[model samples]
Target chain A: MTTMPSFDQWMKAVQAEMEDALLRHLPATQQIPVRLHEAMHYAVLDGGKRVRPLLVHAAGALFDADARELQRAAAAVEMIHAYSLVHDDMPCMDDDALRRGKPTVHVQYDEACALLVGDALQSQAFDVLSSGNLPPERQLAMVRLLAQASGSLGMCGGQAIDLDSVGLQLTLEELERMHQLKTGALLRVSVLLGALAGKALNDDETAALDAYAAATGLAFQVVDDVLDATADSATLGKTAGKDAADNKPTYVSILGLEQSRALAEQLCVDAHRALQPFGEKARRLRELADLIVQRKA
Target chain B: MTTMPSFDQWMKAVQAEMEDALLRHLPATQQIPVRLHEAMHYAVLDGGKRVRPLLVHAAGALFDADARELQRAAAAVEMIHAYSLVHDDMPCMDDDALRRGKPTVHVQYDEACALLVGDALQSQAFDVLSSGNLPPERQLAMVRLLAQASGSLGMCGGQAIDLDSVGLQLTLEELERMHQLKTGALLRVSVLLGALAGKALNDDETAALDAYAAATGLAFQVVDDVLDATADSATLGKTAGKDAADNKPTYVSILGLEQSRALAEQLCVDAHRALQPFGEKARRLRELADLIVQRKA
Candidate 1:
């Protein structure tokens, strides 16, 4: 706690902490309905970029949030992210056979188990979020935020839009709205949940964080679109150029690869600008914005 | 209410109130991702007996809970119930085309839409439950209650067990455990949610309600087993006698129809005895127990 850990060390620490947090929070595989619990473990553990948890921890650092509280918040958001990925990969949806360099839940287990695992994980997210040292009111607020981000008007709503937009041309405004709900909502909530774990924000602080989150959230997807178009399967970890292959609308598809890359950069600038009021307190959040835009995958 | 409306009238009134409440609480069709929202409405509205809501209202009556809070709780539980049915009817699960005499969500919409609808509706359940006149602590408690009943250790876990048990003979104890987690959990929570809306209960009161709910909850499935064996599709409003065809174990499959009927009767007696502490305040609960055990469908 004397000198700061390097950025890579800090991120690895956060990721490692979340690995333990998610494992401890998830229902034990030893529980009855062992297969389902095991699959829940399978779907959540040892997977994904852990980007959502990273944001939670970084935003939490701004206000010096309680360590255990931040861990729970980060795990809860990651669970929501994980469950969405599980459902989105179902045969009736994306039909993907792989995720995180491993067979997808529906492919590894059966589709029914995948469905149940996703449903149960979503429940587990709320269960974990509503527990712990936070005041009851805070717990209720956290639950509300998680539900609103996950519900019809948020991530699921965004996915429905994405599903319908397949092979169709969407205007930039429409695509932005879709991404805002689909991917942006959860990303933004990760920051808010992190901050909430420490203390409620005043209006100006809330507005600043929202602006930063909005910029970084969109930047994350913009980078994703760019990586999908420009990177190889080996680099990206999933299929490369799949959006264009599937004829799904994406920033790269709509804006072209060059313009999509430019948009991501612009979003990064906006995110950095939004944190000027916080100065040094916003270091992790600032670095995260850059990482989101500049990541190769 | 002053004159004490007849039980039939009271039941109708509660149903009417719930229909309106659900309509108001569910996301509107005009929302973006309109199809998903519309399907959510279709899955929840104008379907099945409002047995869970009835239990919520009945339990709320014991504590004279706020009517509006009870409505939110009732709708929340019903949404949870509705989502479970939607997912359970998918091709990967029970694969039923018909539910409550209408095409199932997956059949009416596409399977993907049904999946999203179920996921969104589950989030909506928490959204609605956590938003009302109740204190924040109460809302958090209710959310926790709903999640426990709906998550791996609850409804979904029961389903995984059911999926594994198909075509296999189950012992009576195993069958009871499955049913307890499956339908019993939600039904029991309906009563608990109702009572929770009134105010927190003392240990004795909670025990009384739990005993009553546990008995009636099991009796519900027992009667369902009996009816599935004897009732026609039209009488049941869905396919009947399909359980045996599917090789799923039920109370009547292990015990004779006569014994299942006798068990239902015994449960009804237990339910009634459990309500003795509340005397006149328990009238709706008492009637609900008889309704559950004696209903033809």
Candidate 2:
């Protein structure tokens, strides 16, 4: 077996690629409405691990994907993620004051600006997908997939559940269902879109990628819950224990910390195993799966 | 010269067609989230003049268009309008309590539910466009046009301006620019989409329809400003004179009531004249344009 890269090295590579991809896809900040553009750049360019785009790019790399094509898809997914964050941090939602070690969009700008910024970014994702140089059929597929993943049936639905679960004791199954929709849906879409951008995949390849994405998505969330419980504010670059403080339902809350950690590891293993069909060709995807459950923040 | 139908008769026809179209497009509220679905139904089904949808249908008819095709386009435009109202009514934006003689979506349901409902409706509009039996190329064009019209360059951009313009004096030109983006973009899109649905139009037909939509759209807003100045809540079916109360910059504020009224009439004339090529076939559209500027509320 080829030696695996350290998680830090992998993350550094991912972060650089993400920044380049985002810069390339986004319109120059000076061109859009000043405040709206600023909020878009601020929300997206703020420091985060760039996990979603990484998953997209890494999954595409497994298939020897076109670099520019994958970049657009990666950037679009990140835009959607940023938009969700802006909306989620609003007073009507999670009411977060901090994100990625900086003030949340609403806190930094007015709430109306934050809301409009999110709306603009969300529309921008579809704009990117629709405007991309892909063939019409492929473009339609990408638009439909991303829309489904981002819309009420996916992340938004998950958010609704999360909002409802606040101050309520949610079972492990319920929390899992919520996360599957909220987080897993987009992650899965990212991988699927990346694979689609590369070449059409047969049923087996599609199934395997879906399984890998599903496992890694859940593992990613499991690790996130663990980090929330254990990481310090500086380490997390945000409010570390906010979930527990808000009495939010989380993997740790439902499964206990030890069990949650075990589940994450198992999920990572399953995610890596799902890539067996791709063999050594999917090295980056396998590495990503491994890194997902191991990261501290 | 052919005698024109009475304004009341034209309005009855548009209203009947609008009700039918709305009923046809929306699924049963029983299937989705109870509160959200109910709120959506309440917002759209509640009696309003259905101005946007009527414009879409009338514009389609101006080309001897298919009734069924026009209905779909009409429903799509109205759905977008409804979704915007739902979001605009949330606490973070306009914070209005009343809309169309009923409580605003956020007031009727929780703010979270209102937000999600708006999102669902927005997604649903695209869903209708893409999923209909329309040809793939037509569907793609429709989606692209609607996205641009509803997106940053369109209604949302106008809304951002409106948010920024509050408590500020905007010049007549600036107010026109804002309204053009805010209301005029969607209105123009409605006409363009109708032409598109009727099979691609020649350049002259397209140009004529665009001119018609542009004038009618601005006239629609001017009448809205006039109504806000002179009408009561009972006549308007929502808060009236709120613009003056809030010191919001509007056509009436910038040009005074007499000039605004004259401008509305001139716009209606220009809109009707743009449809000269369509002759008697454009009668419905011509009447709709006059009704828009002449309506009491």
User: Could you tell me which 10 consecutive residues in candidate 1 chain B have the lowest summed lDDT?
Assistant: B130-139
In terms of lDDT, the poorest run of 10 residues in model 1 chain A is A233-242
Per-model TM-score of chain B: 0.98, 0.94
Q: lDDT tens string, model 2, A1-297? A: 987666568668778877877776665667535667767788888468787878777778777778778888888888888888888888888888888889998999988888777777776776676666666666667777887787666787787778878999988888888899899999999999888887777899989999999999999999999999999988888888999999998999889999999999999899988999888878878888887887877
Candidate 1 lDDT score at position A224: 90
For model 1, state the Cα shift of residue A21 in Å. 0.3
How big is the positional error of residue B145 in model 2, measured in Å on the Cα after superposition?
1.9
A241 in model 1: Cα distance from truth in Å?
Answer: 2.4
Best by lDDT: 1
Interface RMSD of 1: 0.7
Taken over the whole model, the C-alpha lDDT of each candidate is 0.92, 0.81
Tens digits of lDDT, candidate 1, B1-297 = 379989889999999999999999998899888899999999999987899999999999998999999999999999999999999999999999889999999999999999999999999998898887788887888888998999999999999999999999999999999999999999989999999999988899989999998899999999999999999998888889889999999999999899999999999999999999999999999998998887988
